[model samples]
Target: MLRVMTPTAVLLLAALPALAQPAHLQPTRDVSVTYRMNAPAAGGAPAAPQEMRMAFSVSEGKQRIDPPGNMGWMLIDRKANTAVMVMDAQRATMAMPPATVGAMTQGVPPGATFTRKGTATVAGLACTEWDVTAGQGRGTSCITEDGVLLRAVTTPPNGTPMTVMEATQVTYAPVEATRLTVPQGYSPMAMPGGAGTTPAR
Candidate 1:
């Protein structure tokens, strides 16, 4: 005996695979992002935008954090574990702090994923709060109802209550600067992953 398939059943089966796949969130680009991380304060220093001009960018799904420092140009590609801490005409340090550096930086991880919990409007922009988890850790990334990370709540493994991570600022404008390109006479350092790389400065 041959079994018959219903059209309803057939369509549902065809859609199952696509439905199972995670949503694709296009990373933000060509924008300026100011990231601030404040710790349990007993005089802990809060993160500030490096005084040097910084432009955020993404390529092939990897995010790069670039800033010009008094020493030279500081470019950190957390995803790639690559860094360059330079000083003009001085010995360059190829030894970057490590992956602990990534515990900072802004925007979503190139490969992290999230699920929408619901919707809300803030500062007149409609937003969505999502429950997010990544290699970086577990957190909530709330995008504008329009679907971009506007706020995030990250929780530590030992159960530190979620710390708020808000986009706080954004604009869909192109960043202008002839070069995010590294200059000549600089050293390359591989950032070590894990606790070792958390930079004190």
Candidate 2:
């Protein structure tokens, strides 16, 4: 039997941390990016690549993500160090602190070292490449000067290339303020373990 994924799981998987950054790489303006992911097949014929569109609107240390295909969106408030997941189809929103979201989206796992390899360009943006190794796993990422991740490839020890994610399109423009907030009429859902709550707009 095939198992179906929860909306939360889909959101987490789709919400790859493409924009996680250090101080120098912080985005200076709002932007939209279209990403394509190619996953290696375990056996038989190759699988088709998956596509996702993401939008980031930045303001005062806060960033919001509008994911593709109505899977809903997420809001990350750096100042508050919190993240809000909005599920429109369910009309429910879940709030999480930075630590929780960090665990879900962190690229380099603990006890890993990252090294800058060189630089390259993607979707008209110049980026620096980094090599990361953690335990038996290894990966590479191409990040822009402003800290946007343009491409990533990862492999497990003794395993074939796992996945490749790349940005294919990028545009810089102002994101409407409304896009960053929860849409009206959604209900706040209590987080598992009773973490906290954020009322819907």
Candidate 3:
């Protein structure tokens, strides 16, 4: 079966702590969030919602995303404006282009507007709800004061809204620096075009 990155991969990567932003897009301190991701099964077959556990680690100006089932991880450097995907099964790394990295690191889509909705709690953490609008996409997000995203529902330009990510657990702890570095021996590989799927989300 074909595989896909976590449903909110782009958003999660773009939302990491940044040096400048009117609103905090990521946690201000070291932290980790485990999310329950729901998306359609690969191959476009109608099936039960696939649930996966993805852990996000953030500290200093770096962020790491550990995808489900230990497939591999992605490391993003906020200061350097770069991102690289580490595939353990293939023992290779795919680096994103600088243009793509720069756009995603902005936290929100260009010209995106946020309207305060209310407040809610998820995974024992309190967060404020915000209605987000950018281009033809619309969605809602629940974010904590320190900039942790607890829940997110996104509607693409002409698609149904889906709950891409929801927090199952949250922990505020220091993350080791080594976890954010690329593996020493992984060889570089050309990034595959459309390497992942969108599924039903």
Q: What's model 2's overall lDDT?
A: 0.61
The pairs that clash in candidate 1 are 98-197, 99-192, 126-145, 127-144, 127-145, 143-148
Best candidate according to TM-score: 3
lDDT digits (tens) for residues 84-195 of candidate 2: 7777678878776456666444554567677778888888888888776667656777777665667777775665655566788988888777766778878777665675
The C-alpha lDDT values of all candidates are: 0.40, 0.61, 0.63
Which scores greater on TM-score, model 1 or model 2? 2
What is the lDDT, from 0 to 100, of the residue 146 in candidate 1?
26
Where is the poorest 10-residue window by lDDT in model 3?
192-201
Give the distance in Å from residue 96's predicted Cα in candidate 1 to where it truly belongs: 7.1
> Tens digit of lDDT per residue, candidate 1, span 3-99?
1111111111111111221242433454544433332333433444322233445542223233222444444454554443443345343334433
Residue pairs with clashing backbones, model 3: none
- Rank the candidate models, highest lDDT first: 3, 2, 1
Error of 1 at 173 (Å): 1.5
Q: What is the TM-score ranking, best to worst?
A: 3, 2, 1
For each candidate in turn, the TM-score is 0.48, 0.72, 0.77
CA deviation > 4 Å runs, candidate 3: 1-8, 16-23, 42-59, 107-110, 156-160, 192-201
